[model samples]
Target: MSRELRLAEVFVELADTLVDDFDVLDLLHTLCERSVELLRADAAGLILADQHDVLQVMASTTEEARVLELFAVQNEEGPCLDCYSTGEQMANINLDEVQQRWPRFHIATAEFGYRSTHALPLRLRGQVIGVLNLFCAEHAVLSDADVKLGQALCDIATVGLLHERVVRQGEVLAEQLQGALNSRVLLEQAKGIQSERAGIGVDEAFTLMRAYARRTNQPLRTVAEAVIDGSIAADELKRPR
Candidate 1:
């Protein structure tokens, strides 16, 4: 498919998340995956603030990206943190050039083979909930158009997350985001369990769990919880055909 057509499709998919039963974790993962495909990024990671205003790695396109995002959060430094705190987009940041500005993050990015990155805030009006991060394997710059497109995606994602229904429920924004973070923890545990049981990588385990969730018409979190609680066997999850 053409890039324009694919981009339009991505927008529609994100918009569909407005439904009452939409999964926040799945939506964030989709955002990361689509950002990598449409924005010339080698990998993508999403970091969202928890109820206590702490940044947590919510989704990533690759294992390396997830590790790097976790490193950023633990070290309390990186483009994502900066972007979230300032509520401004940090685009085309050359990791090598920012060594002095982000010493530990620079080393972490280098170790991950990422030479450049961009951080766009998931913001709506005055509230900034999280950041959408893009990583590049080469020292590169994003064109103005790409930066705009990335920010637009971030905006839409933020709106979807803080849906009007959630707002009308009063103080549910924090609760909703916290619930997604909690779901991520369950997913990680389930992935580890499935990986060990199936002798597969965590990524493959996640794929199987996601496939099972869709095939069974169940929420991904529910599937993950089932796996964690020993209600679902790893062998029960088949790869999607």
Candidate 2:
């Protein structure tokens, strides 16, 4: 498909999250995957603030990106952190030049073979909830158009995350975000179990589980819980044909 058509499709997919079965984890993962494809980034990842205002890795396009995001959180430094704190976009940052600004983050970026990155805040109005991060393998800068597109994607995702239902019911945004973070932990455990049982990589295991959830018209978290409790066998998560 052409880039414009695919970009439109991505917007539709993100808008679909407004439904009752909306899965925050699935939505964030899809955002990361689409960001890489549409922005021509080597990898992408998302980090969201938990109830206590702590950043946690929510989704990533690759394992390396996931690990680097975690490193950023643990060390309390990185473009994502800076973007979140400032509620501004950090675009086309060369890792080699940012060593003095983010010493540890620079080192971790080098270790992951990422030469540049962009961090966009997942914000609406004045409230910032998280960050969407893009990593490039080459020391490159995003065009102004790409930066605007990335920020637009982030804005759509943030709106979906804080959907009107939460406000209509007077639900706390932090509590809802915390629920998604908790679901991520269960997903990790389930992925490991599926990997062992099916002799597959963790990434593949997650793919299978996600596919099974969609096939069954269930939430990803529900499928994950079933796998953890032995209610869903590893082999049952067949790849969608």
Candidate 3:
């Protein structure tokens, strides 16, 4: 299919989140995947705020991306953190030159071959709820088109998350945010189980879990739960299809 058609399909899926079975973290994961597919980015991730507005890595395209986002939260620096804090987009950042601005973030991102970064805030009701982070391996700045598309996707996701519950946005949003964070924790546990069973690294464990989830058309969290509870055997997952 053409890229445009694929993007249209993705937008349709994004719209579907509004009407039913809305899983916030899954939706955000889809956004991250589609962002990497459709944008100039090589990797994408999201960081969401909990009830206390503390940033946490909600979803990422890879284990490396997840680690980078988590490092941002742990060290209190990075484009995503800044974008969420300022409620503004930080685009076309040259990671090589930002060493002084974000010492640890720059060094870590450089190790991952990321030279450029963009962060778009996922804002709702005049409040920043999360951030869509995009990175490129090349030192290329994102075009205007890239920024517009990224911002549109971020806005759609934010609105879908807070839809029809604007009055009690605080409680509803907070609950959903907490749920996403909890899902991440469960994913970690599942990764550990998969790692033990497969004799692989945690990164490989997570990649395997995500692959199983996609292959089975199951929500990632559901697959993780099954893995954690032994309902789904890691040996079964390890065997080739």
**Candidate 2 overall lDDT versus native:** 0.89
- State the lDDT of candidate 1 residue by residue for 1-241, as single tens digits: 8888988999999998988868899899989988898888999999999989998999998888999999989999888888999999999899766597899999989988888999999999979999999999998789999999998898889889887787786757788888898899999999999999899999889888888887888888999999999899878897454
Model 3 lDDT, residue 65, Cα: 88
Model 1 stretches with alpha carbons more than 4 Å out? 239-241
Give the root-mean-square deviation of each candidate in angstroms: 1.5, 1.4, 2.6
Q: Model 2, 1-241: lDDT tens per residue?
A: 8888998999999988887747888999999998898889999989999899889899988888989999999998888888999999999899766697899999889988889999999998999999998999998789999999998898898989887887897878888788899999999899899999999889899889988988898888899999999999887888454
Least lDDT summed over 10 consecutive residues: which range in candidate 1?
Answer: 232-241
* Candidate 3 Cα errors over 4 Å, as ranges: 165-171, 200-204, 207-219, 238-241
What are the TM-scores, per candidate, against the unseen true structure? 0.95, 0.95, 0.88
TM-score of the candidate numbered 1? 0.95
- Please give the CA lDDT of all the candidate structures: 0.89, 0.89, 0.84
Error of 1 at 9 (Å): 0.7
